[model samples]
Target: MNRSVPMNKAEDISRTWLEDFAQLLTKTENVEEGVTKTFLPDGWLRDLLIFTWDNRSLNGLRKIACYLQENLPRSVISNIELDHHSELAPKYLPLNDTLKCVCSGFKFSTTVANGHGFFRLVEEGPGCWKAATVFIMADSLKGHEELGYELGVYGGHTLSWTDVQAERRKSVEVDPYVLIIGGGQTGLNIGARFRQMKIPALIIEQNNRIGDNWRKRYPTLTLHTPRSYSPMLYQPFPKNWPLYSPRDKIADWLEQYASSQDLTAWTNARAEPIPVYDSKAKRWSVTIIHDGTSIELHPVHIVVATGMLGIPRVPSPTDQNIFKGVVFHASKYEGGKLFSGKRAIIVGAGNTSADICQDLVFHGASSVTMIQRSSTCIVASSTTRDDLLRGWPEGGSVDIADLKAAAIPFLYLKKVLTEHAEEAIAKEKELHDMLRKGGLNVSFGTGGSGCFPLVFEKAGNYWLDVGCAELIGSGRVKVKHGVEIAKFIEDSVIFTDGTSLKADLVVFATGYHTMHDGLKTLFGAEIMDQTGPIWGVDEEGEARGCYRPSGHPGLWFGAGDFYYSRFYSKQLALIIKAIQIGLV
Candidate 1:
């Protein structure tokens, strides 16, 4: 094989390889063997509702073979053509500036829908360039492709935008095909996707405003992720947007997002405490209450995007009945200035606790103490943005960034990030040493992944250091580790280790139950038990019970960060559309 030309021009090599690969896929007998030869020994294949109406990641020969053997006969992937668009042209993209991959995009079609994909290949040896990862994402179903933005009128001044909007609102309000229960980023993104796919969806927000979920949090709160990494559907922040947006700024963006998308949303509306599902009709009977009036509606699908957890898990102290100072869950505690000139004791050392501690120090709290029941995973905000958000470059298209991030399977990414986390700690040894010297317990993340995979795991147990770590390291805030709260008194709080701290305000930053557990009241214990696990990863490291079939007809769950919501919302929409149309 001639290697000099291939080495000199990665694009030419990729073009030739893709042509052969497309031809290889035509013959059934050669397809499996071709995949084995083309991909690395531990290559990854991430499928977002292309092969089937589900999100899946395949690694190694066994999973790939089994998946293809089961679904390939039915999926009948065909019309594999390489894309020649300038933006998607074959090029050498670097991974962490260490490994080079010749990447190219392609267009294809499955039995159910049409799709596009990107393949990243690396030079394995002298003449072998093997695929490191291949990502296939569904673009549209055969008949349910997202409609273009076209004026309703062919010849102008006759159509009223207001009337059209009202008609759409009434149609969905009367009998929505999908009902989303929260108006936060997750719910908003899901509703936006449904809107684009022409699905009748109504978003019920319990708060008085669409963005209140973010606005109600403590002031001075800012997002830890970079601006390029945090964006709503279809809209990128202006070039002048801040690197780290404040909470209120984000809240305003969410409020604007719903309006811009023209989504049907009801603020200050709550679905009934419990919904009754009619199995025969395949619909859920729910009532939305606004102010005092109630309206009955029957939606075929119900998406519980309220949160990862709805109920707060505040601890009950034994002696709280005897004497008490001001005590409340962290959610209820508005701001640190409210507790000015008063001693504060906060239980838990996760993100919320860290934020509260930092807020109190900035404000005039007489003293602040944090009770860390267990060690915490800590990484600087800047380090996290650089380490986890490398794919999301400044002034780049978010679509490409999302595709690149989703290319690697979760389990493989977890292993890679763990190594990066270890390197991060070693590099920031001075900061960690000071934090330990000041008595704050720290864990580098679950399995030492630097808390990158925790979003797919427990969702808590980590803090992205903003300014609180510096304050803690400098002894501005006191830390009490390895002790649980024994009881609370009128003037002081006692610990199980027989230590007591004088306190005027106590805040429980303790986390809540798992998302599935939070649904017991709304879904009832029986149905909740039957549903699949909501947030954590399953054996294959794919997110369970979210953006996929929830183990029950007409029920779905939407959860995760902005990045998670942005990409998976489409996955959720595609599967739901397939189900509704009887195409799956």
Candidate 2:
């Protein structure tokens, strides 16, 4: 058997595999037998095809076999067809350093919905292939498809567009199906999803503007991810747009996105009274205060789309009243320009602290010092961007790109990456050398998996260096590692090692508390206590307490950066839509 011969027959090979697999599924007398014949010995399945009615990522044939026993045979999926698009075609893919497999894609349908599937095949012997990983995702529900193009008001309409808009608004004002709190990217994106699905959702934002979440950030702040990596729902940034958009520009885009998407949102609004969920009716009766008027609304679902972090966490040192310099948490940090000609100290060694240190030096601060409580994982921005988004192709169809990304289960990716961790750490020899020379302790993260896992485990434990390392290496910025802040004197910040650093201003660049505490404040201990863990990976490797369930009924949590907010919020919209139509 010639090794290169399969390249010519890749299509036929994949087609045959699909035909046989589809028949194998229908003839499944037993779920265990089905898994044995169709999947690899160590197979993986990322099932979101509504058979689970929830998202699940299973590793190994044993786990997949057990899950199939619970959710299959009743699914009745059919209409399997090959998808030969450039991105989803059968080709040899280097899944990781240790494994290379032939990846192919297909489309399928269930009784009430449509879905896409991708399988990575491993050649067991000559003319033999078995699926190493299988991913199934529901694309849309039947009879509830969204109109892709705009439905303009033509000549034969009785009501003007404004009147029609008002009528549609009035209908939801009476009773909305979903109530979204906090109009950040997550809230805004979710609202768009509901509108397109014809599900009534109302967003209440405490801020005065739709994009105030971005506007209120530090003046020097900018999104490091490229524009293409984090597109808005139904809108991509202009081609000439900056790769790294400034804060003010992003704020404007978000404000325009809400208007163009026809999202029903109320700025300067908040849930006045704690929502009371009526189990009998399966609705939450809550009052919202909008600019001075209080309105009552009963919504079947309440989505808390607050920003990733809840409350700003500041350290409380003993005898802090003696300090005179300006002190604030990173959340309240205005801008470093105000500290020009002054000495500045930034506490904590996460991304926030690194940015502040850079900002302080750039703003002509006489001296800038960083205090590190623990070692931090740092990677080059270019390397991190490419590695995290390798599944996505530049300037291609995002739908296909996103699905390809979704096919890799986070847990499976983490395990493989960890096994290949030394390879990642090896490529950063120069960056680590510069950091060590700058007197800052560095790490490739726990288990030497580098910084990827820390993104979810402790979102603030790493920084993607964008010129910060050079500044620290050149001595433009100073670093103090492995020490905790002890106290503050009138002229200097005292450290646990009895050393002190004098500064005119100090900022604690420490991270914030998770949404659990803030939700507890909004919904009370009863609702909070019942909720599952928020902002971390679960046993199945999916993010916990969000885009799925939070334990309490009629409550959901939506959050993450632009990419995550889009991908996961879309999934949340599907789950909610399914629940609304009695599918789950």
Candidate 3:
């Protein structure tokens, strides 16, 4: 088995190009304490290099020169290989060609180091080439072998497990540098990132146990995305894990992750009253109630990782109190078994609504109806796994996939997805027609961007169909499109369309209010207003009030899906670290 053979001509060229780039990068030198310089000329880099660290575009030449000088070690690059497929195609003109490559190799950085690089090369002349974009990320200087012993009891004087637990239990008395609110995926991820940066962070979860957020969801609920796209930092799910994990499985995984990652999380804890920020001290004084005991904590930074929809938004109908039935928000709906042999009306046509409607039908509900107020972007699970996640490496390291996903600019990715949406809708015209015929309203989402952008931009306008569409299309689950509940009548609901439907349970899957609303109770209305909206893309195409500075000092928001938290947690950690070190 000859391992050195190139898979193709493009791979050979890519490998050779990356080797040359690594050689030049290793020769670079630091010019100052935090800055560096390289001999690479101006034309050797792209105008805008996509940085995965914060998903920000940087001046390619300057950032690359600085990064290489600061991070690359002076050692010979070895075992350079094309990690993924690459292609050579014409660029700028017919005479100029571009070579896109992603490669990996090893270098000596205190020890044997691994690095992954994504490169774009352009033919400057017939026989001359220049780098259009060069993005490289290397492993930490410290190797696993060197740090592995620190994780276990190595000496007789080592701290006992009970003592360690006690220290965490008493963390409320000690002023931590950062306090994260929420024990969900976002908070856990931020805690992990802060731990890796050697920053003291305490996570306060209102639930009795970690991962209860997912555990409390409906039994039929499962992750819509594949396992490959939902890994925490440094720890990926085992290959034996389900492709689409169920609610309880994910809940258990999160609990194990928090423990395995050594993140300090105070469960069965609630932030009492509201946190008051002291301007003179530049710290937040927050009171927590745990197990009937009140504890105080003063932290320099407060991160609200309670998710984008931190507070449930249950709309009040004109005559709501008169309804003679069980009424609850989607968040409170445990399962459809309780509604068995009963008529149910689920308000809202989002993913949760769809899932609940299907669950109701499955649980032997006498009648189930979904009241759709607007069009929903519906994409098949297969399409999502096969097309949206097409180029993503299967069974590869999630960190690598995340970096690759981040390499593409958001707007550009949106455009690409828009085109994909158009093609997909065209291919599934019959499915769309069937759903429409079944009284369901569907769209390709805003600006044809489909479900991906809708998730970030609106958070509730789309749903990735996982057999629910089939149920709706087959008329197993009923849908009432283009209308709202005019009022709730006794033992029946009157719609805006002058129609009426009998119901025993009314579930409002009307989504939730922005995280800013949740902050209002914690911080005064003035401070909450200053924070602006939480989720949605900004002018720079990044998440508006997340992983970046909030107008209020020392306050940050960390919210999103698993992959999102995994990527942006580091960014939030870096921002806090910078503030702590006076680098901001």
Candidate 4:
């Protein structure tokens, strides 16, 4: 029997990594140890420290080694060794105390890409022994800078730090370090798309690799929506290919796209930005700490393309710690290679939950059960496939916006009419329905909610909400109402109905809580003013979800809401271009 490594329950594994490797900074000398450390000069000492990690997977160790050797100056990274026997163990160690004494400013680096790489002190005398580890220190401003480096959307640009305060004149700063936070489809697309536009962005992912999440998906997962309209910029999904690409197929395409574009440099760089608003300069001072050194950037504008799927939420509340078989968010799900013969339960009613169930079953899960709190409009892949396979003509390509624009004239004409046509029509419908019930009239007119969705007098109330109602009636899926999960009990979930389901694996395909907790802290009261009732129904009253924070300026969401439509990305790209040219 194979035993797994005892892992922390938290999704963000980097937090634990920082704690474990904090010891390595003990031997290294700080560039300047004052209350402020953000102004440290950028040089060989700063550059010599090559920090890396395996953000993609446990296998990212090799990729980090290759990245360091390829990108950094020669002789900086040496004596690389891999030990397979030491699985889940720290591979590198400090050299000796003697060498440490000679090297006063000796430094160590940690890999943010994956939690594997560590710094070492090499001493070659009297049987060299490993010495103390160094800890990288970050003061307030410095901490913010480091955060910005890892999480900042904009790439680094060259602008004198002090000169910004000295002069308020708008001057363009040339791009230097381009940081892209997300490693998802949009993030990858932005990097690829912008690189073609001649701005090379250094993409940083919290995960291990470019497409690890996609590759680990269940076998049955396929693109439910139209694929022809959905694709990375410039690179179209090949024609004659299947209308619905499997999960792995999309993953493979992303990896290939990156490889082809020579974006391997972005593989292990997990940068977080610490943004400081310079009141004097009227610009944000963003600092990014990579490995162990700070690289401050003054960007004219920042693009936050962090995708939606980062944060996972549970719908109906259940204390996860109570039962403790094996629980994880969809983001952390690797393949079910180890789950053969085990029963699994997937919760939630979205595409993610659907994929999870399909994947678990394919992985040899003994039994897989899905629990949904509400009915979803379950349109099959057939409609989506047909749409993609049969391309629409130019006239048909007019989007929802175009249709709405055309409806403006009709609305004006309706307003001008003094005959009370709408009220008359309502009266006629009521009278006709009353007569029809009495067997006096037998005319079937397609009366609806008077609008697209709200009307349904002629077709009957059943057809009004037929989509959702039928899905519940369909025996293909299990339906539950007033779902109240009591607790998780010993490889099973107990419901408020006093019913318990045996489960080997219970997945919360639950919805996602807003991933803007970090942003909330950063923006403070401004965030509340910007988001404007976060969980409320009137989402679009502001800027399409979370975009209104800056009055529709500065804030750029890559995958704000995935269901918005394919044109949303194209619109985003166009906005970015306009911003670049000062059009927006």
The runs of at least 3 residues in candidate 2 whose Cα sits more than 4 Å from the true structure, single-residue gaps closed, are 1-6, 95-99, 154-158
**Clash pairs, model 2 backbone:** none
What is the C-alpha lDDT profile of model 4 across 1-584, one tens digit per residue? 11122233111222233332232122133312310111112101111112321001111223322333344332222222221222212332122222221111112223211111322222223323221222121111111111111222222545554454224212212233244566667677666555444343555555556776576655555665455545554456676656556778888787887766544234444444346555454344565554455556554444455654435565444665767577766655666666778777666555566566555655677766556564332233443345333432222333322211221222222222323434434544543343223222122222211221111111111111212222233322233444656787766778878888776676676655554554454345553355433221131111233222223234445553222323233334333443454433
Question: What TM-score, over all chains together, does every model reach?
Answer: 0.95, 0.96, 0.80, 0.50
lDDT of each: 0.83, 0.83, 0.71, 0.40
- Candidate 2 lDDT: 0.83
RMSD of each: 2.3, 1.9, 6.8, 28.9
Which pairs of residues have clashing backbones in candidate 3?
Answer: 46-132
lDDT by residue for model 2 (82-134), tens: 88888888887655454457778899888888888898887767777788778
> Considering TM-score, which of the candidate structures 1 and 3 is the better prediction for this target?
1
Q: How many backbone clashes does candidate 1 have?
A: 0
Give the runs in model 1 whose Cα sits over 4 Å from its true position: 1-8, 85-87, 94-99, 152-155
Tell me how far the alpha carbon of residue 451 in candidate 1 is from the true structure, in angstroms, after superposition: 1.8
- Residue 73 of model 2 has an lDDT of 63
